[model samples]
Target: MQNPAIPPLASEFSDLPATASHGPLRIEYRWVNETAATAPIAVFLHEGLGSIAMWRDWPQTLCERLGMRGLVYSRPGYGLSTPREHDVKWPVDFMTAQARDILPALLDALDIGMQERTRMWVIGHSDGGSIALLYAAQHPDELAGAVAIAPHVFVEDISVESIAQTKQLYETTDLRNKLGRYHADVDSAFYGWNDIWLNPAFRTWSIVGELDTIQQPLLAVQGHDDNYGTMAQIDTIGERVPHAQLVKLDACGHSPHRDAPDALNEAIATFIKSPSKAPTSTPARSPK
Candidate 1:
């Protein structure tokens, strides 16, 4: 449960114009430490099945600790943002569309111009991490750096297995009801992500070939015990981007922020402060 003492942050909405494939959308977002007008912005992107509510107070806590302003928002189909039609399905290039079109449009809607964009940093988890990497690759000069936690550059058998299991849990258990609290349309959020990943055509989907274009400082993190993906995910990132820093946590799983907050926070703070000097791995710590 979220701490009742920490009230929900004020939220604002941005309207994104219709694109070639979809209608207009209203994105739900909030700012952390907005008073820090001069500080660089740290944009927080959630996991595939995450939303602004699912993120809770972590974004605020991290921004305060780092002394940086932060941006947290729900993608079109999650949170209070516009939900997808029940009959519609996300495309194979859905994540790509987010990185290439939706994110930029949100920035524009918020009046964040090119100048502010260049001073920004993207911190993302899971599917969001993959989107961050894609954004970095497509617009190398728009951001200062990027941090990808448990991001998948290429689909693995383990990923498929885990996702398949999650589908079962969603159908047979109370997963839907649990996730419903964070989203206005839980089925949209769940199915959009689950359907695409389980799609046979998506098995070959990989962003490894596009990562060579990213020139900014990059940090890739994964848990030694992550069920959704393996260290090979970040290992491949390091191989592609020589300067990329890789951090593998012990006793952690798919969600580092929830499982190893202290270590994850420390690593992120250190790397964002001194991108070149970040430790390659954090010492093993008990999962929270």
Candidate 2:
């Protein structure tokens, strides 16, 4: 069964010109709750391995709950977006590049001018979550608020270990094949994320210093039992951004939207309507 009031998610593509550093990018983005009257835009950025399809109906449901229009998009090399070359490697600053370059460019190509951006909100998960933090730091004036779920502001041993296990699964199991369902080039997406994270040089990666520059209200969520990152991620966010709200969830893991959608939804809605730069009425779970 489905609710008629919920707007069905639909996707569109745009061909963006090449940058001096990278080649052309064809971005795939979807609209959530399109039937609703004009409202704030909630932009969703997916996990490293995630794509537009990986989000399923969560974006639509979240947008419906908040009476906002949603925009969920796959970064280059994910979903139906342009794929990365098989031999090329992602730089350590890949996530930074996305927040600093790709996001702004994508919005520009979509005709979402600078003025329209001020009212928009960004909700990002995992790697996307990190990018959201960077985006806020990069474009502080353009966003109303941001939600970062299970975001990694720095490298950790647990993250490296978990990613190593996933890489092994990709080699020895059907993980690659399964990922193929969501990524046009699963290798491109997976390897791009994996190789960079596992790189020894990335061990010192940290966004904590950069977080202090973000001027918008932020909601950072994390699961107590997450294997990929610890509470330090979101906690540090609040420490850096004085107005940032921290939500720590119980009986949850890396993905909050999947593990506790109702609670996460309520918490987010409460934060958005709270009318102040303060703590959330409730807490958080996982986001996928």
Which numbered prediction scores highest in lDDT against the true structure?
1
Q: Which whole-number lDDT from 0 to 100 does residue 161 have in model 2?
A: 100
Cα deviation of 131 in candidate 1 (Å)? 0.3
Q: Please, what are the lDDT tens digits per residue for candidate 1 over residues 113-213?
A: 89989999999999999999999999998999999999999999999999999999999999988888888788888998899999999999999998899
lDDT of model 2 at residue 16? 84
Count the clashes in each prediction: 0, 7
TM-score of each: 0.94, 0.93
Question: Over all chains combined, what TM-score does candidate 1 have?
Answer: 0.94
- Model 2 / residue 204 / CA error / Å: 0.9
